[model samples]
Target: MEQDIANFMLRAAKFEFFLVNRDTSLVHTKVVGVFTAIIGVNWTKVAQFVEVAFPFNTFDFTNSGFEIFAQTAPQYLVIKHDGRLGWDCDNEPIDSWDRLLTRSYAQLRNNVAHGNKHQMPAPFTHDRTAQFLPAGLALMNFIANQVFLESDWDTPIFS
Candidate 1:
């Protein structure tokens, strides 16, 4: 798990590099392949992992202009939706900011993979890549922390 997390971080860095030098569609497609493995199909572990820091009231989605969540087919929805990406959610909408972030990421991956690029969500779009990258990276770090509590993840990679 530790090595896998490290590989994910390295792949994320590569994603940024490609975003800088390649077309947006190409970068999106490339990232989908690796990121999917990291997030996995089931989200129960992610939900349990993030329970350590839920609510996320300190993180303001409105101010950041990222909607709490985005779906491919919101119009077909009603009240009480189940979580995706392997989340065994009850008949309730996603309730936490972290889960919302993962869901948004999953939606983006789906959009790219399933040829639904037109349905890509706000924060996951190429235009907002700079703003969204930090949050995604932080979430990746959170996963790493959950897997190996002994590691000093608090230390900055750069000064």
Candidate 2:
């Protein structure tokens, strides 16, 4: 389990390198958003393609933007919804993880993939970057530490 999480974090770190090296501005934002959703799919049972099935302690993943774990899959996701904030999955009409993803990373990913790159955070700002990039990276970093105490993830070198 520890090794699996470390491997996942290594991949996530590679993505970070790509983001820092190849992407900038809205492109960077787009990359970050996509990366964020990827992280979501891996962390939660949201998507199955890159699904990471390690022994994750639900207790370690509660709150902090994640829905409280219900057995395995999360019961809900914490994100801004409607004209206000907080939208419960049961009360809303969400057919996919789009509505429940953290910071609407799925939405940004979908929007970019579909060529509707309008209203994006315009890069150079956390609006798009904050949309997920840092949070996802931080989450993965945290999870990595939780999984591997001796991991030197803090001193990442893109090489």
Candidate 3:
């Protein structure tokens, strides 16, 4: 039983890593798409569309404006909702990890899309480039653990 549990944990860790990488890649692609849309066209016009889509006030181009937009981007909405629901239900909040990962990715996307050349913060800073992999892995582990625990493995593992 002990060996089986150990093996399961090891496999879970590997699977979690894989899931995180995949999720991060997907999020990164979405962020890039949003960034591209913003850059490929007039930012003022794009900002208007973003405002309407998100139903928020216009984002100022100032540093504080970027900071606010970074924190409240729609990409992190599901994570935030999950975190709130988890708290309301008295469950452990795994969504916080997702939010963190999303924030890291969003910041990177924002900087690149906005043409900022400064270095990003630590945990995100890697070899002078932003590194979002760690946060992504953490979020993946949280989600995988939740799913594994809640799932009935006794049933067929696949369809």
Candidate 2 TM-score over all chains jointly? 0.29
* CA deviation > 4 Å runs, candidate 1: 1-39, 52-94, 108-126, 146-159
Best by TM-score: 1
Which candidate model has the greater TM-score, 1 or 2?
A: 1
Put down candidate 1 lDDT per residue, 1-159, tens digits, no spaces.
Answer: 234335445645543343334222222232465563232333443444445554454544453333434221111111334543221223346556445644654443343233321343333333433333344555445444543342344444464
Q: Listing every candidate in turn, what is its Cα RMSD in Å to the true structure after a full C-alpha superposition? A: 13.3, 13.2, 17.9
The backbone clash count of each candidate, in order, is: 0, 1, 0
Better of 1 and 3 by TM-score: 1
If ranked by TM-score, best first, what sequence of candidates would result? 1, 2, 3
Candidates 2 and 3, the one with greater lDDT: 2
Model 2 segments more than 4 A misplaced: 1-11, 15-131
Model 3: colliding residue pairs: none
| Winning model by lDDT | 1
Give the C-alpha lDDT of model 3: 0.32
